[model samples]
Structure formats: structure tokens, C-alpha cells
Target: MRWWRQLSVVLALLCGCATSPGGKPPPEGNGPPPPVPDTLPWTPCGRTAIPLGPAPEESDRGVPEMVDGERALFFVAEAGATGQGVWASRGTRGPGSCLVRVLSPGPTGLGPSEATRVGNRVFFAAEDPEHGRELWVSDGSAGGTRRVKDLWPGKTGSEPQSLLEYNGLLYFAASDPEHGRELWRSDGTDEGTVLVQDLDPGPEGTSPDRMTRGGDGALYFLAHFQGLSTVLMRSDGGPGAVELARVPSEGGILESLTTAGRRLFFVMGHLHDPEMHLMATEGGAPTLVSMFAQVGGMAALGGQLYFSATTGKAGTDAELWRSDGTEKGTQRVKDLRAGEAGSAPGGLTVMGNRLFFAADDGTHGRELWVSDGTESGTHLVMDLEPGAGSASPAELMVAQGNLFFSAEVTGRGREPWVSNGTAEGTVPLDELAPGALSSDPRRFVRAGEDVFFTAADGTGTRKLWALPLRPQGQCGASASWQALRRDVVTSAR
Candidate 1:
């Protein structure tokens, strides 16, 4: 398949719009929208809904990153017809109500950009058709976009991808004219962008691509030094990039990386022979932490690492697992019977004492499930109907003692859904405007008492949305705020 086609397929899965083998629409209506409010509340935070508009074409949008504090949202919006660009949305309510803007390219057309946020600024990379993908930044404030680096300017520069914030500087990976994929940094200034070091160092090698900050002050990533072999590397944002360990070339591919305490943990091996491995940040051999499991998603919460993994003879099912930095100590927390005949863990998040995840028990297609570190406590929070398949939960967040997520419902394509960890607490947020397709809640960042997210409109235009998270029963007795409502108007039409 073409790169654009692959990108579209990924987007369809991420956006919860799976098509049949012959390209027919999936099932419909997980459930009907909540009844309309009889009267508007003086302050209704529970009733707000946000929308994430449609794709530029039928292609896909992928890799959404939420800015801390929920001030903005960033993601790669790609179209087979228009290529790809980095898009930003300015609120949390849903897509229709927030202001949406596309970042400017550095004299060349932009394509396939990824973003990360630090403080009030959002940094990303966009293709400089002439110089390759370069680093850029945008202040969350209105009219604050600017290009940070063109790197090689005219020559084929490394594609600057994967923006990660560490120690007040933004670190990323890009191909340079002289070096393959090397580590680069930006100091929130236009002139500070430069190559930190090349992990590959020799010819025909690629440095680390996805740079993630570890619990220690150092940065950890993966690089392919020789042949098709990939290795793990660490850097302290200085000139030296240290090689930690080489992944087994035969069947090991490091899919994801994270850190807890002073240990660097990652998912290694293939889905067929999966294992979660860990290594000390001081540098040593990686030890297999878990076995015969395919890790789908992971997150760190309260010094423990929480992830979604599947374990079975055929490697067909999935469950939630948590670890306290020990091999024998690691164990399964929740099993949704995923990978059986047909089921899987969709998305995961760690908040307070609970691990929230999405799973399909066959009957509900896919719905939200939460576990409190006990098998008996594992239960479904939302039972989505067919058609509106709630495959995975995206943008899982905690706001004002409540849990919020984005999922597709029976009638809704993909919309924002929130829960208080119970059936009575789960409901769809109503859109602020009528006739808007409120779906794809990118991420929820807290800004004071309000939670913000990136959403799409009916026309498929992306924008930011916000909702004020108020204390329960504070909005008065007659006021019912069960659904999401929008906060911004779109300029598409």
C-alpha cells in the first residue's frame, strides 16, 4: 500500500471508523443521545460537547498530542490528495466550538508533521518540500506561529519528527545533510536549533527517532546503527549520545518506551512473541520483565507503570497489567477476554487508584472498562451498542474528579464521552451547535477549572473546545448537564 493509504488505514482505526474487507461501513448507533435539557443551567459544565471535523479527504489524521493544561491540541492531518500538514486546535469542549488553524511552512509546502507542547508554546515539524521536514513552534496564543529551523535550508535535511520536551528544551529527531537521523534541540528560540549528536555516528546509519524523556534527567530513544538492527540510546541533551543495548534482530522490535523511577522500560519483541523489558538508566543489559504478551498501550501513574497487553497461545487477546519495577511482581490487573474469538483492549489511562481502559466484550463492540487492581472489581463502565462501535478510548483524562474520554457511539461517528467510573456517570457530551459532527476528542488538558480538547466539526474541520468542570450539584437542581456542548464557531462555511 502507498504511504498515504497506510496513513489512512491507521487513521480509520484511530478514529474508530473501521470498514469491512469490501469497504463497507461498520455497524451503527452504540446508543441514542441523551434527552435534551429542559432548561439551560446557569453553569453547566456536564452538558458541553466538542467536535473533531472530518478529514481533508477520506484519508486520515493520526498521532494527536495534547498540550499540558489543555490549552491546545496538535496532530498530523494527512490527505492523499493534499499530502500532510500539522494542524492545531485551541480549546477542549469539542471540534466545532474551538478555533482551528494550520501552521505555516518555511517557504516550502508542509507535509506529515508531528507536534509536542511545552509550557505555553507548541513545537512541531513540517516538511519544507525543498529542505525536508524542519522544526517549528507555535505559541498557544492567537497569531503566535513561527518556524524555528529550516536545518539544511536547500539540501535534503533530515525529516524532523517527534517533538519531546525535556529539561526546558525541546528535543527531536531529524535527518541532516551530513548525518542520517540525528538528535536535535530547540531552546524556544529561532537560533538555538541544532544537531546535538548523531547516535549512528558512522555512514549509512540512523540515529534515534522518537526521543522521550525518562524519569531521570536524561533522554531515552531507539536508533538503527547498522544493518536493519535497532538499538536503545540515552542522552542528557549534551554532545554525547550513549548506546545502551541492542535489540535482538531476529524477533525484537522496540515498539514503545517509557520510564518509572530510575528505570527505563519499553515494549520489546514482536506481537507474536511479546515481552515488556526494563533497564536501568545507568546503562546495563535489558531484562525481560514480562513474557508472552503484546503490549498495546502504556502510561505511568503514581510511580507505577500501567499498560494494556494481550496474552494467549495465539496471542489474540488483551488485558491490563501493572508493575512496580519488578519482574515477578508484575501481573495482570484486568482481563477483558481480548484476543479470544474476537475481543481486544482499546485504550488505557492511569488516574488516581484506577486503571481505565477500553475493551470489546463481543456484545458491546468496544466500551470503557476500569479496574482497581482486583479481578472482582473489573467491570464495564459503558456498554456501547453496535454500529457506533466504541473500539478504543482516546484522550483519556481526569477533570474535577470525573473521567473524560473520546469514543464513537451508536449514532455518533466518534464523539467525546465522559464517565464518573459507573454506568450512571457515563454519558455523551452534547454539541454546542446544532448539526455539527462532534467526534474525536484528541486530549484533555486542564486549564484552571476547565478542561480543553481538540475536536472536529460536521464538515470535518478540526478545532479546539473547552468545558468548565464544576462541582456536582453546583449547577442547581433543574439544570441537567449530562452531554457535551461546544464553545467555538467554525469558519469553514
Candidate 2:
């Protein structure tokens, strides 16, 4: 999988669903569905502002996992006397729909997490009194939710990490008494769930990690050895994984395993000595792309990989760059900040044909910027914070053809904002915290017609908030626009 899909998978793993003792029974009729308005509103999805986490204590609900295109499954953490487990929402059916608490907590709190869906079921890791923390699967029902297998046998759970689906099977990094922490795959059954390979053989397994899918539909990952080195390995669902390349332990830190432009890319060594490497899907020795003083976020568009980095050359200090999977083709797109300060472009998100990122052009602080893979086409989208003041837009996500992110305004604090890649179109979605307090909306995921996020409600506890995929108004105009207008009016008074 590419970076975006990989990120979505990781985010989806944080929440899950099951039937719980603390949950209320499903509501009666969902009430007549609200009349579809000309423009959508920034309305809360559940019947009430159900604070998954109690007051004064922020909710531990991370990212959500959507099922059946309507319900959202999330993990709630223990707070005070409250139990921790999985909770589900009754879709985007207006005020009548409410949240359903599923997956009862264990003695030490179930801590249900790393949930991913495959076929008709969702696979996740959770803990129970009888089985510590092990692999679990749920069909969105009380009876259907149960432990898949006790990989570790007892209280010491297998502790599965990096849950990924490849070839209709779920692959993860798990530890067992016999295999240590090796690669394991499952078909949602005890018998079908078994170790893929012993990589390192004995008790101390290879500790395979960063498992991701390539363009060719093969699994690629990094496996670490005791004190020797880390090897890049590829697997085609075969009996054994193939080692492609190795980096000595003292060589440098090998990280950022990404697939872009139909090629697998990674970085080895950095700051003083960094080398960007790429390997072809046809299989061969990895080729050195280029070296950088520093490298940050990366994304691919039109068969070209765009990233933020400094070329280690004079007057180059972390600017926007693009690569065609070659040393010569990799070059800086522009020096938005002029001199050596560089734009330091991050949050590289591909919305439509342009790349949106957070960058400082010296005069604009760190505001929203866009590029079409060219110097002339790349420029500041808007001075959201006005003079030198930064909106510092982050968490950029493309939803319903518009860019959604959390940005700060001088008086409004930090809140969610939506943009159409234009100066007039970029506007604050809502003053979620009211007044100047920031709700700090984040973890944006678009499922079905609504985009869900986690934010504070001025009560200090973060709760679920969502808005229509296509809202009406001047800047995502909706009933929420009135909130921002009210804030401005009050400020004028």
C-alpha cells in the first residue's frame, strides 16, 4: 500500500466494535431522517454529544473505523470508574442516532486497539481477564466478537503490531513463546492463524516491522538482527522471505519505508550523511537516488514523488522537492523562503492535481501552500493568518474534493478549517470551542458522506465531531458559518 492507504490502515487499527455491558440498547426508530438541506451543516453525528471519555478527563478515543459505510467503531479508555473498550456509532442519521458501547472491559481494561477490517469482519488486538492481550475478530455483534487465538498462550499476549491485509489474509508482527516476535498471518480462525516464518529462527525472532505493500502487490518490510544489521526483505506469500538489502547497525538509521511512483523508497543515514534508496519491483540491488541533509513528508503524483528536504548544497535549507526515482531527476522545486531558510514544506497532501502543504515563505509564517510540480505553479494559497501570522495548517486531508485541516487564527485559536485551494474559499469551518478557545480538531477520516474527527468542546474533553462531505455556504457555508460570524460580531462589539 502507498503512504496514504498505509496511514489509513494504521489509523483504522485504533478503534473497533463488539457488544458491551456498559452499552445502551439500540434506540427506537431513528426518527424521521432530517430533511436534506441545500447546504450541509457541521452537525455532531450521535444523538447527543456523547462524551466517550468523562468530563475533566479527555477521551482516549483515537481514530475511528467505519463499518457498513455508516457505523463508526472506536476504542474508549478507562476514566475514573468508567470501563475501557470498544464503542460504535449508529451512522450519520441525525439526532435520533446514538452511540453503542461494545466490547466490555477486562479487569485491567480491555484496551482494544489496532482494528482493521477484512471481508465481512474487523480484526483487532484486545485484552480480557482470561486471555491477556491477544488477537480478536468481530462481526459487529456480541456473539460474533471473540478472541481469534492466544498466540502467547497465557497472560503474556502475542502483542500484535502492524496489522495489514494482503492477499485476503491479515499480516502482523506478533510474538509467541516459540517464535518470539516474528511475522504472522490469519484467516480469522485459530487453525488458519499461524506464523508466516521464523525469519531469525530461535527465541529472539527477527522482529519484522514496517510491513507495507508495493506497487507489484508484494509485501516489503524491515527485519532487525541482534547487534548486526537490519535487512530489507520482500515476500510473495511464499515459504520464506527474500532479503533485498542490508544496512549495518553502525551505518545509520534506516527508516521511512515508502512506495511511490511504482517504486519502493527508503532513507538510510541522515543529517550529516543520508542516502535515499529505491528498489525496482522487478527485483534487483537497491539503487541510490540521492543524499539529503534532511528529508520529511513524501507523496506521489503523476508518477513523480514529491517531498521536503535540503539538498545539502549551498543556500538549500529544507525546500519542496520531487523525484523521478533517480539521483539526477531528484531536485528542489523552489526556494519559497528565498535565502537559506527554505519553505520547510510538510504535510504533503495530494488533493486533485496539486500538492497542499504547510510552509513558511518568511513573509507568510507557516500557512497553506500548493504546488503543481513546478516552481511557477507553486505559491502560497492564502495568507490565512494575515501578515506574517501563521495559520500553521496541519493534518491536511482531501475529502469530497476539498481540503480539510486544523488551522489557527489569531482570535479564533486552533480549529478545523476547509478550503477549495483558493484564497476566498479557505475559511474556518466552525469555532468548535466558542469564543477564542481552540477545539484543536484532528485525526480526520472520511467514511461515506461524513468526515469524522476528534476535538475538544471547550469542556477540555475531546469528543467526536463530524460534518457533511459537501456542506453549503461561502467557505463550506453551513449553519456552522453562523458560529464564526457570531464570533466575529462579538469581537467587533
Candidate 3:
């Protein structure tokens, strides 16, 4: 059966009959009822279809990104398939959608790797046929890919990981023959590559990972300098890197770091006990911003920073928290009280004045959730039906006013889903392709009115997919409503 039909059947079983406001029946509908207003405040809408690519037999595909305002690419790791690599797709929507071949290198074949974009080129790390793992670059325009550096050259280089654009150059961590995992940088030019500084240069020294760009004009990263403790470091593309702060010896570790304005914010401690904290760019004491104890994912928008934090110890519920970089003003933005169970929030993005996130509120496996700083107004916009055991949203990206994400709704697997912020506006963008699971749909760049994302064919092949923002006058009502009818009828059948 067409995946869309399967989706509809699943949703119908989950949502039951569609009735008007106040439980009123449709006014004698025969030849298709009047088109619903696509602009419902917070409805979800969009369609999902199979992306074009050589579907693999089995494996996981993910970590998608839009690049150069045109291409969408992602990594495909075939469970046991050798030479696993990254694939690209051009033009997010319509029949012209297809994959563009790129580079892949493993031990004897290409293994799984992560990719990020800088300017017109895409930078990633993959196992080299000779070296362990090396940094490679692609122009996004299909062609031959080249190894930018062999880091270790002759000996053994475990893996050159964490490719990030900072201070006008691409910086990453790689393990050299002499040094464990040290910091390296490239200008995308034959200044070739330079070792910025080794996090743990000694034999017993640990490696530094998770390199993040801070608003203070320096790079902030997490490393285990001594013992098994993880500490945060700041480097200004200089020789002497400064150790900004260390994780408390209370068995806590910092997980992620992000920058907003002049302050650097990060998630501190393990998942079991988490807290959102902030530090100055010039290096100072780390301040605890929230007492919530369980924070996940943080994004800075406008002048305030938003993140997900658990409100209670129920272990099943969480809420969105916002801060103005102040301890006293930190408060919950969404008033979703803990129910009999709780919700797990994931993937957050900022568009204009709103903050978007993903959550599984016990009922909807995992659907799109949004907030605009109003406690009473926060709610679910898209509810992937079937109340199944599998639906879960991966990443959230905002492009041209619409939000895009990946979810596994059809027991078949996870696929790319889109929404316009309304419950009725949510739809799957890649629900047509059989066995196509789209994960990590991110808006890397916007070209004209279109948004591009990386998606994996659940069949195992990972590739890029693009979709245009609803054009003016194209659909009389809001595109959200049009996307609802189109996506629901088509995918849900």
C-alpha cells in the first residue's frame, strides 16, 4: 500500500472522526467540503514523500543539513554495508528531487561520519582508507571530493572529529600519533592544516570534543584535562588556550555549549541531574541559571535564551524554560502541568518571535510542540496519529515561517514532517516513499521561498530533500491549511 494511505489509516484510528468546533458535524458535505482555513493559529501541516536514492537494505541514516541555499545532505550508515557515505539532494520539492553523489571513505570502505557547512563548501570526517579518519571537503556542487588533511599522515589517526566554523576557519579535533585528540584548523586553503593546541597532548591525556563557537569571538569546547573530569576551554585561535571552567567534582559533566550575545550557556551535569548554566566570554565563574535540574537543548532568540527543563520529578514530564541571563527571572514559558504521565521534549529552533520544539505528550508518540513565551498558550500543533509506540520527532528547523522536522510515525519508521504551527497545519513532507524514514531535517539555508533538509530513506539510503515555502496566492487560504488537506489526504489517505 502507498505509505500515505497507511499513514491516513493510522491517523484515523488514532484521531477518530473529524468534527467541527464544539463537536458539530460538517454541513452536508458531498463533493469535498469547503477548504478549511489553512491559517489556524497553531495547527500542523505539510506532506512527506519518499526521497530519490538507492535505498539500502538495513541501517540507520541521519544528521541532515541544508547547505549552500540549494542542497540537502545527510550521512548514511549501513549497519553492515561497507563504504557507507553521505548523499545529497537538490530542489527540496517536486519531481526534480533526486540525490547527488559525493565522497565516502572507510577502513577499506567509507564509514559513517558527521557533516557541517561553511560558506559554499561542506566539511566532514570519515575513516580514511589509510589513516583512521581525516577531514574532507565538498563544494556541495557534485564533483570529486578531496581529503583536506591526513592529520596523522603515516602512523594512526583515530578520527578527526567535530568540524566547526569558528574565527574565520574550520576547527576540529583529531588524534595524532604523538598527541591524543588535539585541536586542528583549516582555512579551506593550503595554509594546509595547523594544530591549534592539543587538549590532552600527553600519553594519558584525554581528547577534547564538542567544539562550539561562542559570541565572544572565541571557540568554546569541552575536554577532560585531568582525571576523568570534563572542563570547558576557550580558545581565540591563539597559542595559549584558557581553561574557563571545570565541571564540579560532584560527578557532574557538561554536555553541550551554545553562545548568545556576550554570554556562553551550556547544559551542565549528566542527564540524570542536569542544569542550565551560563558563563562570561572573558572567563569568569559559571552561574546557575535554572534550578530545574533537568535541562535539554538550549537556543538563544531575541534577547532571551530558551531551553527544555523538567518541572517535577515525575520523570515523564518536562517544560520549556526561558531566561534573560538572570537567575531571579528564570521561569517556565509553557504551563503544561505534569499529567498522569509526562512529555519528552526534543529538537528546538527559533524563528522570528517564536520558539519551536518536539515532544511526545504520552498520547502523540512524538509530535511538534511550540511556544511564544505565553504560559497558557503553549500546546501541540502537530499530532502524528496511531498513538503508536514509535512516533518520535528528531530535529527542528525553521525556514520561511514554516517548521520542518523528522519523525517516525508509520511503524515503517521515521520520516520528515513539516508544520506551520497549527494542529491542523502539520503534515509529512516525505510520506509517499515506502520505507523512507527522514531524520534530522534541518534548515541550513534559505533560497528564495524554499527550505532544504537532509533525510534518510528508511530503506537505509540517506539523501537530501527540499520544499518550497507556500507561495503567495498559490493556495487561497494559509499554506498551513492547504498543507493539512494535501498532506493528510495524500499521506494519511
User: How high is the lDDT of residue 246 in model 1?
Assistant: 75
Local error of candidate 3 at 273, Å?
8.6
What is the descending lDDT order? 2, 1, 3
The whole-model lDDT of each prediction reads: 0.57, 0.66, 0.56
Q: How high is the lDDT of residue 91 in model 2?
A: 26
Expressed as tens digits, the lDDT of each residue in 11-84 for candidate 1 is 22223322221112211221212333435222336554433333221112444444433223344444334454
Using lDDT as the measure, the top candidate is 2
Q: Give me the candidate number with maximum TM-score.
A: 2
* Residues 1-493, model 2: lDDT tens digits: 2322332332233223333222233222233234457455433222122222321112244444333233343333343354544443432323212223345555455466666777656788877776677888865444667899999876778878878888888999899888689999999999999899998888888888788887667898888888688888889965578988887766544556677756877777633444434333435567878777667687888777888887555535779998888878887888888777787898999987899999998897899999999989998888878788888999898875678899888787898877767765566665768778998877676653456666788776666655644244422333343444444333322
Worst 10 residues of 1 by lDDT: 484-493
lDDT by residue (1-493, candidate 3, tens digit) is 2422332222223222232111123112212123334563332223433243332212124333333332233333232233454443223222222222433454545454556556555676656556666777755333534677776775355576777877557887777667766777886654658877766657554567778777667777777766657788877776678887776535544447767667777766643454434433435666766565466677887766777777555544576777776777778785454573456566778867877777665555666677787776677765665554535666676665666666676543556666666655566654534653335343334432345444444344444444544444443354444645664644542
Error of 2 at 369 (Å): 0.7
Which pairs of residues have clashing backbones in candidate 2? 1-213, 13-114, 13-115, 472-477, 473-477
Candidate 1 segments exceeding 4 Å error: 1-44, 50-61, 64-108, 127-132, 139-144, 202-205, 248-250, 270-283, 362-365, 384-395, 409-413, 431-450, 454-463, 470-493
